[model samples]
Target: MMTVVRLMALALLLACGLAQPASAQVQAQAPAQAQLRNPATLAVEGPVLPGETVEVAIAFAPREGWHGYWFNPGDAGKGMELRWDLPPGWRAGEPRYPVPETLFAFGFMNHVYKSPYAVLVPLTVPADAAEGPTLIGVRAEYLACSDSLCVRETAELIGNVVVGADGRRDPRFARWEAKIPPRIDATARVEREGETLRIAIPLPQTQALGRPHVFIAEDGLVQYGEQQAFYRGEDRLVAVLAAKGDANPSSLSGVLRFGNSGRGIAFTAERGPVGLGSTTPLEASNAPSIGWLFLAAFVGGIVLNILPCVFPILSLKALHLARAGESESAARRDALAYTGGVMIAVLGLGVLLLALRAGGEQVGWAFQLQQPGIVLALLVLVTAITANLAGVFELPTLAGRRQASGSFATGLLAAFIATPCTGPFMAAALGAALILPTQYALGLFAALGLGFALPFLLLGFVPALRSRLPRPGGWMAHFRRWMALPMGVTALAVLWLAVRIGGWPFAAIGLAIALVVIAMLMGAGRRQRGGRPVGGGMIAGGLAVVLALAVVAPRWIDEVEADAGVLDPADFSEATLAQAKATGRPVFLWFTADWCLTCKVNEKVAIEREATRDAFADAGVIAIRGDWTRSNPAITRYLESKGVAGIPLYVWIDRDGEEQVLPQVLGPDSLIDLAGASPKTPARGTPQ
Candidate 1:
């Protein structure tokens, strides 16, 4: 009865981007000149020698709430336009700006100077001429914005510079030069791998980086808001950024900020191999330590045992325990074998995941399920196991014999199936593992396996726990038969998942193959019951049919369309997300996959409810859903930006540009409360 209760619980548990054009030219005459609260003043650092250059600084002192744009104002705002009125013999160079801070507003990332800042332009003096004072003038037009409003402001300023030598030099030029990022001596290299852009800048490994960030000067080269991944080699720092648009340029210029030390270096990178073979991941300053990550992985593995997705596998383990408990040595042997099997499977998966990422594949945890071939294989295996548990034909050794190998195989199957569910604490560890060094990541995987096997291991080693189990007897046979129910449900679930991942025709072929194998197995069982030979011909025929069907199934496979949900969310892409957020409405973005059990549970419990739909309607929330059942590079990049390795991620961006990441496990009222808190506002026009 207890087995049936556990089985019942197990049954319940089982159940494109587009390129954006370059920034448009902002017409200076679009808006009337407003009050110059954030005003610009011009000055010259003078006593300029003939044939030499003198620096002219255009300084702006913005009000407390006002800010001015940088030379390359990120997503919105206009860069300063300066028309120079210089002496006939003099020439002005391109303007250089200091590293600017980032501002995210109305779904746009703006590069601006919040406080006092300066733009320096060098003035070249002619060799032939003037020794007296020369008049220099510039008409500076720029956009200044506050949190809620923006204004176009223009200033015309004039300054004097002595060409010969009696004029005093401005002392502030030294400070202003310090603000500009100095050009690095060594050239950098950048490579675009699919949707990712990797830039390698030559910097000594000894140099400390606080919170490094790369700001590309070229418009539409990379996504301005995506978080970057940094790595440090012996003499170079490599930054991985998400690429935007379809523009492929030969060379790129960017500024690399060395943390919060107010120091940065400007570099130009050519298109080439970034050759940073082996490097250490440089995490953010506030990231947790390795020990904490290990603990989290271990705890997460323990928690997975209770999750509904793993309950079917647990039933198998329970039956193994019942048989092994009769003998102490047998119990210990089986426990060790099981542990070994689990460790091998988990570590193997970890290595494969890392290897794929290293090879430039954008994939995450349980990536195998994303492939139709793998899902088909899993369906076949589960169906066979279900039949075996239901008193059908036995395999040569695994099903009929009680051997360590059988226990090991069970452990392998358990771990393989349990990974689709990411319990609490697992997300952080796995996310970090992706960026951590290979060895450390493997250690975390090992820790997870040990934790998963710990409970079963203890039962074998500790006689008191073993004694609590019911003695091995006739009940064991009935117990095994009943276990078939959950296994059958599990098989059915896999069949449904196959349909979702592949198309109906593909699933139908797979189902027919499973039935053929079951019929052959039943025949073998009847022959054995009659004390006649279970012919090898029947087994070979079944194997041939299964192999032939598996080979042909891919032909019928079609792209599975996303199921319509209650919220009726638009399909998620980077372009679509930007468009939705541009409307200045609250955005509710969630990512889920068909095979993810936890995501299904969440949809049923929290997301797909009428309350959530009504609340979002009231709040004017734009719903964007990312379906990741298949491999999607855009979705993978977004997940990496959020520092997560798996799905069921919820992001809420309010109308005011405030972003909040809700918990992975959602409550019944989580969406309702979130929507209710942010009242609806009139839709704002998209940023120009």
Candidate 2:
């Protein structure tokens, strides 16, 4: 008896004490990425022969009104730079850039690259060339600028070759040369629409350069702020774009910037689609690949259905429903019946998919992945329910118990969650599914869902499977208790994603509410059986959860999405912010990462303060601010999203927003005027 008592005490100590370490570990699940997503594409290549220089460049594919500077950035924008990851013997060189065009913005005129451009690097090899093959790799970093702000980034590009007695073209070098982005065809037509521009280029296959950029010189033609290029059919590449300023179709003179087998170059464009009047060897085309796409997506669905984060909750939900199953005498019979439900639901989805494909409908890999609001809502709901199960809060059982509950709920959740986990089989399945006939698509989906569910279903139908499970006894209790830990972990995760969208306040409120419910339940548990402590635990639990959810539900429903600000654009005018910069005074804009959302949204809406009309007014501010948005590439490198995982991105080009950042939110008057306070010398001729 003493021994058993001692063991129980030991187990309790471990669970409670180690919970912190476990929770901390769970929180750290976020990836430690090396770089933020930036605009420039990195390039690296080198010839092994002595005296041969392998040239490389950082290419910028800008949307419009955007340009980036050479190694030496002129005026306010950042300079393009390159880094190398090569072997010991291989030597790297700096960017050998083409002379830049003069860019005029605000009151400043600086030389930079406009449209898509590349920098050349001349690599030098020694007279004694290496006998074997050598490899060279590089990262290209550059800033792409638009009228509003700049996006800086480093990308990976690679090239390698063998060296011999004399400098000669090697087959490997030839291979890379082929991969070089092909130039834009000379014969293409540019068309302009409201906030959108389309360039029709004739092509048979979609080339990487189909979205190649172009500029329009005519008044009222071609928008700058929005530009997107895609292949609309099998015969042409259409560049869709947003029109800026005046956009008149006729009398529009456009210039198309594209790359040929040789390098980046431009061609003068006339208004209208490319008439049959001209034809080039190059044509951009992308026919729908119905068969392959469906196959890939189906495969992806299969893989994702079993992800760790998803699987546990699915099993438990089904288990709850399974209790309601009428048959209990034979466990095997119960398991088989549950298995039937899973197969039926999964195969049914496959049939539905086939029906859609028959209608010539287009489906993307997890086409449903784009709905952010829906994703967030589901995540919150699932995690919250799981939290309740873990004893974080209590709730009345919504799902009836039955053998089918575990299997049925698992099947349903698996199907839904599979959308985001496409991998491996994803490519082929999705490709085929989208293009194949309805019958074909459904067949592919069937294979995928069936493949995914087979393992779990097999385990269910086979009672011997119990042998694989830990023995159900005192250890089972320990396992159930430990299981609660994962529930807490899952709840924390859902809350984390929520924080990114809803901010820290929402998360804190959620945790706090759950806490209260737990407390109340504890209090209720002390009641006698007649009135009941059994359900008392549940009452306290439910209250804690409801209180937190009370805040969360309303916030979500209200959808109060505004830029969380240090500048509080509502507090100041764009013209006002710009005027501060024009006085040669550096207007410091501190884009806080989290009081609300990532710094990106407010960063763009706020930083691009001086629209064309206010250009001269806001020239002095450097727009130097920290980015705290989720997956914000620029800020990620600097560990800039320093506060909460999300919220109230503060602006401080003028003032640090230190006081505003305090209490973790922003308000007006929090703005500190720079000219009157800081004694630092002001910048010259800076744009407002």
Candidate 3:
């Protein structure tokens, strides 16, 4: 009986009511410094001058018993790395690294740092350097070592190199910046062979190793994190090149993050085989260790609460708790109930997935969103909840007593809407859950569920936290009444997304049903107590409309695939692109997912508009889209090749294959302009 009650509560909450907002848990745990056996800090200081080649240093701060690494260690060593983000119109000169020394550990000659050593980086300010505050962000993603274990960390360090009005040196820079010597005679070469693109950097001297320390850093060229690099000889540092998918060497080009003395050391790494642009064949999964997989899932789950649907519901919950101002025990009970509700939903999904898999359903991890029916159903649910949240309906039958029914309902509704906002990390985590051994997969999902439920649970268990509340008053009534606007706006937004997916007609139908449902709910509210006649016909109509919608929604959902009018090489057939170039127009390609809120927002207000379409038609532009609703290896490769770590990725391709990947957040005008940039030349070809 309790289970049934819980189920009904969940259904009502998910389908209509606004979510309760719990406090957002910001998990920013400090990475342990004790784990910093060989701590290194790189600082950029100079007698700041315009166009002066100068020195910046990377200093090691190793613990008494632990040590760090040099550029090249004799054997079994990981080099210290520094990555630099420099502003435009500026260049950096490579550092002259201090030679590494070898120490014996466990009967093996391990090259490492026994004390602090300084490796210098030379900065070269361009002759055409624009005068401004030069702020550089440095991240040290280094492998720190101890006798027993190695730790890899990425930490941020910042420095300001001010270019002066008179081109005079900043007194602060004189302390540590070093100038790169002129006429250095070494160059690094990158090449492609069957399974790899190999890079060889000539070392001025011999160093011991099975592999050399190699990093890829090129603007519009080179792959990172995926390439396999090895050292050949003391003077020869070899790295294998792997092209991002469909991104050909006839393709290779994009910003690459490579290793530097401080992390961004400039080595003229070679441009390997132009013919070796596609690197999809070599994407071998080194499958993350089980422990690593669990951690990733947990963290990913924790981040889910920040999604649009989740947060609003959480906000409502916060308001409810504030209203209750109850004891810690009460709060804890509420937390447990809420968390249990969320977990049951997740577990239900898991069981459904497992059952489908058992039944030989060809469903993947994205089975839910991939099905248009599911997406449409979810979209309708969102609309209903949003309307309810806007306070268009009054179902408060326990009118005399203040009940949190609505707040709890909102939280349930939020989970349904939020399911689609899954990020790459979520995909990766869920992928592991689906692919690993049954026990392992279940545990991974369990961890994720626990993580997602943690914040609300925290609210229940902490009384002091609960005591912090706003008393119910006139202000409370006003706030509740006004808060409905955002919910109304959100409903409109979801409706727009539906239109983009299925076209104007589907959007109209879905909307018609929502209006009918709302009108019935409102009419019923306005009716006298215990009187069913007023909204009776409306409710009957709404139910029938809903049943019809359930059948048609999936079909409509399958129709909408939206993108940022950016052009990607992978989306274009080279033959087709050649035609587009002949016309002298650019192309826009947008990659999207159903779960992506930002994508839906962009599609409605920008991409799906007739005005925008007509504008593109006149501009000789080309638009292509890749949807991530279901797994597509082709799309994955295209993204990786472009060096995008994540999506709603928008790429703009000029007539010359000059590409610009836009930001995650898209503006309508910017998207329209991106489409307009690619106009057909005199050889004018029709867009694909």
Candidate 4:
């Protein structure tokens, strides 16, 4: 009776199992949530040729509010894990992904794609395969998430590709391929600083990378989703990333993301010091070393002593040295003081320049002369000097005084005027100074001042040089008078510069101030000659009024129209140069300042001449001039790019868009010859 009952129970259980529907059982076995989301689809890009490789893409189109993870998913998601099913003699390469966007949800950061995207895998066919269709399949495991919910999904994707003699490309493949970050020929250095890693890469200093971010590919090296700090050092791009615990990878590999372009480059980290390689125009990889730069600065200063703008001043100083011949001890003392003054002046100017740069001011050589007020002040001083030289006043104390202060003042004046000329070798040294360490830059300036004062310093020590100078006599008076002519010319040049920089009205006011100051000086001379206190008081009051005017004039003067016929070349801008180069035409670019006499001479001789202009027009040359008359940061940066510290920077770009740096001092035929010569594409770094 028990055997019969047990058999009945087993038969009833079997009947109940048979009654259930097969589709319902299958649906119950697989989670209903997994079936709700669509699976990814796989497709071959095009026909695959035997022995040739073609792209096989696994594409996913997420539903609204859902997203897919990138190769290196951040914080809280899983990337696509592919299990490939391939034919016997076939291979599949690693997946290539497009740049990813950041997604934040529930206190977790994710690198994901919210829209449809494809991951590309290279599929290779067997060399001897027959012309037939082959099935490629992949089992993809990924995590898909919306803002509120997340799900782990599995998709079985398959595609068919035809093996043919020649392969055809798919349009979809091109789109995905374009999105993948390009591999860059770059090296990086990872510097571990406590809890942060400074990853430095060699990128162009000129690139405007706005708030750049880094996406590390290596696991556990960096804390993803943490804020990245970016900085630029010379030519290196650096990112400060929060480190994950004590994890330090032998090499860091990553992608650098700029904004909205969805463009980036993959870089493999090089194990070494975090070097901000050659961040300056002067410190370019191929530029001269520090020692050579110092030598260049010294040599440049020596050359400045002979430039036309400086020649007259040297003559006056030399004459002063001759007057000192009466007492060797006094001469030596004066020379020391003058050298001290020169060094002090140069270093002081250097300090000001560095300070301004630190404060983010766009300043360069002779920057002080850019201001109308300073120009007017210098004009007055020079005019007064000329009058004294011409015997309008007996201010022989300037050079003939036994006091060291007079020599000191002369040294300061020499340095002041010397700023307007960039001698041979100066452009490189000074440009380097701007980018070098602060101390190194100051050292260069000191060397330059030492060179400028060398001649006078030598005369004090070497009695033979001093003996060579003619003894002081009445003829010295006549020589001094003749020097007044050059001094007056210098004053007139300042006046002209005032007009160029501040316009005609400013120049007119400067002229009126000069006349008034000259009259006051004349009155003081008369007072001394006639022994009259009344004349002295008149002179004092006149000077006060002149000072007041000087302080007030620049603020009130109307900047009027500039004089024409001086070759008003188109103002040079980066855009202008780029546009000119894009036209496939040659370009002539020159940087000039109102105060740079060498620049003026070059313009009048080479650029402004009729022959040069005609040649430029005929050759379709774009003539562009950068006026450094004011504090133009753009021009300053451009000058630095060419390793130039001062003006008269002439750059010639041939039709091939190669830059040729022309000589600083150009002759009448220089531009004409340059323009007439047919453009030749230069090899890398051929001297301009």
Q: Estimate each model's TM-score.
A: 0.61, 0.34, 0.45, 0.59
Candidate 1 lDDT over 1-688, as tens digits, reads 1123223322332230111112212433333233465688888987888899889999999988989987777766667889999878789999998878878765557678998888999989899756888888988888777775565677878888887878787867766765677564345789987788889886643233557788888877787777789887755789998888665668999888755544466878888887547877786322346787899889888888876658657557767777666789888988898888899989998999887775446678878789989988888888888888888977632462468887888888888888756777777777667767678789989988888888888888999998998878878888888888888888888888889888899999889888987888899889987889999999899989999999999999998889889988889887777777778889888999888777888889999999999999898888889999988867776665454678778888888654566777899999999999987788764322
Ranking by TM-score: 1, 4, 3, 2
lDDT by residue (tens digit), candidate 2, 86-194 = 6555566644454345555554334466655556565666656666566666665554445544444445665555555434543332233322222322245666555
Error of 4 at 87 (Å): 60
The prediction achieving the highest TM-score against the true structure is: 1
What's the lDDT for all of these models? 0.77, 0.43, 0.51, 0.71
Better of 2 and 4 by lDDT: 4
Q: What is the clash count of model 1?
A: 1
Choose 3 or 4, whichever is better by TM-score: 4
Residue 438 error, candidate 1, Å: 1.1
Point to the candidate with the largest lDDT: 1
Ranking by lDDT: 1, 4, 3, 2
Q: Which ten residues in a row have the lowest lDDT in candidate 4?
A: 679-688
